[model samples]
Structures are given as structure tokens and as C-alpha cells.
Target chain A: MTSKQQDKDIHQYDIHQKKGFSSEEINAMSQSVLNEKLDNIDAVTLSRLHQARQQAVDAAVLRPSFLQRYWPDRCNLSRSDHPILQPLVLVGLIIFALGTGYLMSHTRTDQLNLGQGEYLANEDDLEVAEDLDFIAWLIEQDKVSDNHAG
Target chain B: MQAQQQRNHLDHFLARVERRAFHLAQLATGQTQPALDIVQDAMLTLSKKYAHKSPSEWGPLFHRILQNKIKDWYRHQSLSQRIIDWFGKKSSVRDEPDDVIQTAVDRQTPLPFERLKNEDLRQALNMAIEKLPRRQQQAFLLRHWEGFSVKQTARVMQCSEGSVKTHVSRATQFLKQQLEGFYHDQ
Candidate 1:
């Protein structure tokens, strides 16, 4: 086909043309084509091609090396053998436990402190009375007279 | 037990498609490690986000995830950077044949190996497919190699069917030209 004809009629070419080329012909044709392309493509590109296939298979197999980043599995454990609650559920449980524990501890601490404060105040009352000076003594004597009248 | 069954189904599905997916990703990235990383990411993302989706939805859903990963990689690497990244850093100083002239060269010459075995031909075809522009390669692979319909290829490539047609056309033309020498020799 002429260049213009090739350009214009290119659309008529079937993407999946499996008609004329035998397996052997296809092989021979592709080899030449590949060799030409490879002449242009470098070794690094070849390496990338190798990695892409390996990686795809690795991911499909769910290898630990591929899964460890997103999964909660211990690096050394087999995923199938060491069954644990799903990571999300584990996180939820931990949060619930921490919240309840904090609330219970906080309430208990508040109660203990209140009891200690009351005990300290009672102990200070006797000391205050014994240490009272003239103003405190007169105030106490007046409080005693008022109690007698009542 | 039900979860286990679901997991089994997913494993089966992935096993069946793994090689093709790997090959597709390899073609896109033109190397293995990044392709592997992208494929791995796509698999995890698909399982996490779409495993609960219907079984029939898996192919397109997995492909969409893969497409997004490819785009993310491309976004990080500029066009020139992509060439360097795919080719190599040290190779930057080496002059490349102008792509336009190379395209002409690719059109006129027979590929070097006209007598390679069938397996080699398939490998060669796969390599040539890889060297194609990203969209054209995807279009060609999805439509011809994978046997997806144009509409399906369009959906996978996230473009209109018309765009798919254009990509396929260009890809076929390039491939034919690239394969012409072998054909003539045969």
C-alpha cells in the first residue's frame, strides 16, 4: 500500500487480526519486530518488564512482603495460621477499653481525694482550737454563751 | 466460613488474571519493579475497596485501580523524566534517534529477527507492544490481545470508544509497520 493509502486505510486494519499468520509465522514475525524494538529499548526497560510480571504475581499471591505494610500481621507469622481479629475490630476494642479504664480510674481518684480532704480538715480543727489567741478565744466564748441560751 | 469462601473466590479470580495483569502493568511501566509495586497497590486497593462489589465487577474494577496507579506514577514523573526514569539516569547524556525519524525507520525496516520461534515471536510482540505510546498500547492490548470489545477497552482505558478506535488504529499501523519486514521476508 502507498503511504497515503496506508495512513488512510490503517483504520481498516483489525486490532485482533488472527487470520493469516500461523503460529510459526506469528512467532517469526514477532521475533523480528521485538528485536527491532529491543534495539531501541534499553536494559533498564527490560528489567522493568521483568519486575512488572513478578510483582503482579506476588501481589496476587498476597505474599507477606507485599501485605505487611497495610496488614497488621507480624512480619514472621503466616497469615493463614495466625488468625486474629481484623485490624479494624482490634483498634475499636483498644479504644473502648482505654476510655472505660480512664473513666473508672478518674472517678475513684476523685472520691479518694475528697475523703482525704475531709480527714485533714477535721485534724486541723483541734490544732486551730489549741493555738487560738485572744481574738479566737473571745469568739469561742461568745459561741459557747449563744449555745447555752439556745 | 462465608468470609473464607469469599476470600477463596477472590484468590481464584486473582490467580486467573495475575499474569495478564502483570504483563499489562509491565507494558505500561516498561519495567518490572514499578509495575510490580503498582500492581500490588492496585490489588490491595481493589480488595479493600471493591472486594464487596459483585464478582462481575472485578475485572473493570481491578483495571480501574491499576489505571489510577499508573496515572499517579506518571503524574510524579514528567515526560522527560519518565523517559529518563524508564531508560535510566546515567543514560541521559546519550543522544536518542529522534522519535519521528525512528518512527520512519520503524515503518520501513524489517524487524531484525525474522526466523525466531513462535514463543520468541510472542515475546517480541509483547516487547513491541510495550514500546508503544501508553494509550495506544493499552488500547491495542485491551482490544486485540485481551479480546475486550472496543466499548470495554474504552471503559478500561477511561476514554470514549472513538478515542479507543483512534488508539487502536494508530497502534495497529505502528505494529504492522514494525512487523512489515518480517512479513515481507516470510
Candidate 2:
């Protein structure tokens, strides 16, 4: 048959089938036959099917939840079996420790600098007070000497 | 508690559809082992990825997964076959005769229809369905056998509704042509 003719024939068949002119009945019958065929599958095949299904169920049961499957170690920190998270946690801890050490050292240096500044200021004030006292004592002695000479 | 409920729901859904999914895979691949593997793989994928989806969505989701798995298997087979051919090896795929397709369905027990007493017609119907293009076969099975609506079939097949209707129409036409004698005899 020509391609056009074949197309036309197929279109007609489509219409006829859609109109349910015995085609529907045939479809139902064929479906039932297919169902029976599946029902009566060989024992070996059925056994294999059962095994496959059991395996699937077992796998499904063992399957992790969304959080467990995707985030796994990230979600449940208690589970040590997470291969990816262990290294990640170790690295994170190392970074955190390094950051804290740097910040602590910086803070301590700032405090030490402030303490040194305050100590230097106190020492300078004490030295100035002692110098003032000595100068005052010399003036008093000089005044005593002048009174005696007079 | 919710996790456990979801697992139970997913298990129940897989159990419900396992047989039909197997049959569809079997028909699509025309082999037993590949079909079994496809079904199992589809089940694993559905449970792994989509177990959290609502129960109503599972049907189409599972079928879509199954269909994609079948397509992947076909692509793998063809690619391997091409490599084998390039090496000048006697390709096992080419050695299989076209008529060998009958053996898959012929192994089935007979049906009760008086009109279907002729086993050739039954085999012809099966062969004809198997021989359809992947889209048409998917459209036919999803719409007619699985009773999916055109919209649902489109969703499962990842096609527009118009495409689903066209595929189903063509599938119905071809199936009618192949099984015309049985219908006419009635």
C-alpha cells in the first residue's frame, strides 16, 4: 500500500476503534487474556519476581530518609558512618580553632599594649612628683641659708 | 514516626504496582532478566527519590521512572551493540531472528475467549504492541491498559496531551489493523 493509503486506512481504523464497533470488546478481551497470561506466569519466573520484590522491599527499608539519604552525616552528627562529613567536620574544627587562636592573640596583644601604656604613664607621673619634691626641699634649704647669712 | 509511615506507604505502593510494572517492562524489553532489573531499578529509584511524594503522585512517578529506565537500557544495549559491530564480532543482537519475538508471548497460557482460540491472533496482538515505537507503546499501555487519562499519560510520557492523543490514536489504529480479523469474526 502507498504511504498515503496506509495513513488513510490507519485513520479509519482509529475512528472505528474509537466508535467502539467491536474494537472495545476486543480490547477488553485482549486485556483479560494478557492479565491471565501474567497470572499464569511460570513458577520459576514467579519465584524470581518474588525474590526481586523482596529484595526491593528490603532495599527500600534500608534506604535512608531524605535527610539521611542526602544530608546523611550533615543531618545526623551522631552517625559516624558518614564518610563525607568526618573529614569535613575535622577541617571545620581546624579552621575554627585557628580563627579563635588568631582572635585571642590579637585581643591579648591589644590588652597588653593598653596595660604598657598605663604603666608608662604612672611611672612618668611618679618621676615628676619626686623631682618636684626635691626641688621644693632645695628651695627651702636655700631660704634657710639666706636667713642665717642675713 | 512520619518516616516510618512514609516507608510503609512506599512499600505498599511498590507492592501494588510491582507485577504490572514487571509486565510492562517485560513487554517493552521483550526479555525477562532486563525487565526484572528495570522494575527493580525503577522501584529503587522511586523509593529513593520520590518516596516522600504524595501517594497519588506515585503512580505516574513510578511509571515515568520505569519508562526512563527502559529507555536507558535500550540506549545502553544499542551502544554496546554498535561497539561490538565495529570490532567485527558476530553481534548476538543481530543473530536473533525477528520471529523469535513470538517466543516471549507464546510461552503464556491460553486465554478463555472463543474468538481468541486462535493463538496466532493473540501472539500477533502481543507482537504488534511490542513492535510499536516506544512512544506509541507507552501511550497505548498507559492509556488503555493502565487506564491513565490522556493528561496523566502525557505527564508520565513527558509529552503534551495532544501528542499523547496522537500516539494513542496511532497505537489504537495499528492494534486494530493487527487484530481486525478477531474483531470482525465477532
**Relative to the true structure, how large is the alpha-carbon lDDT of every model?**
0.62, 0.74
- Backbone clashes under 3 angstroms, per model: 8, 0
Runs of candidate 2 with Cα error greater than 4 angstroms are A1-23, A61-150, B1-5, B92-118
Tens digits of per-residue lDDT for model 1, A1-150: 699988656644643253233434443454454344544433444444445444443334322343344454444443335656455556887899999999999999998879645644787765665676666888999999999999
Q: What is candidate 2's CA lDDT for residue B163?
A: 99
Candidate 1 Cα errors over 4 Å, as ranges: A1-150, B79-124
**Residue B183 accuracy (lDDT) in model 2:** 53
Docking class of 1: incorrect
**Predicted candidate 2 versus true structure: per-residue lDDT over A36-86, tens digit per residue:** 666555666666666766666556543446544555343555332555676
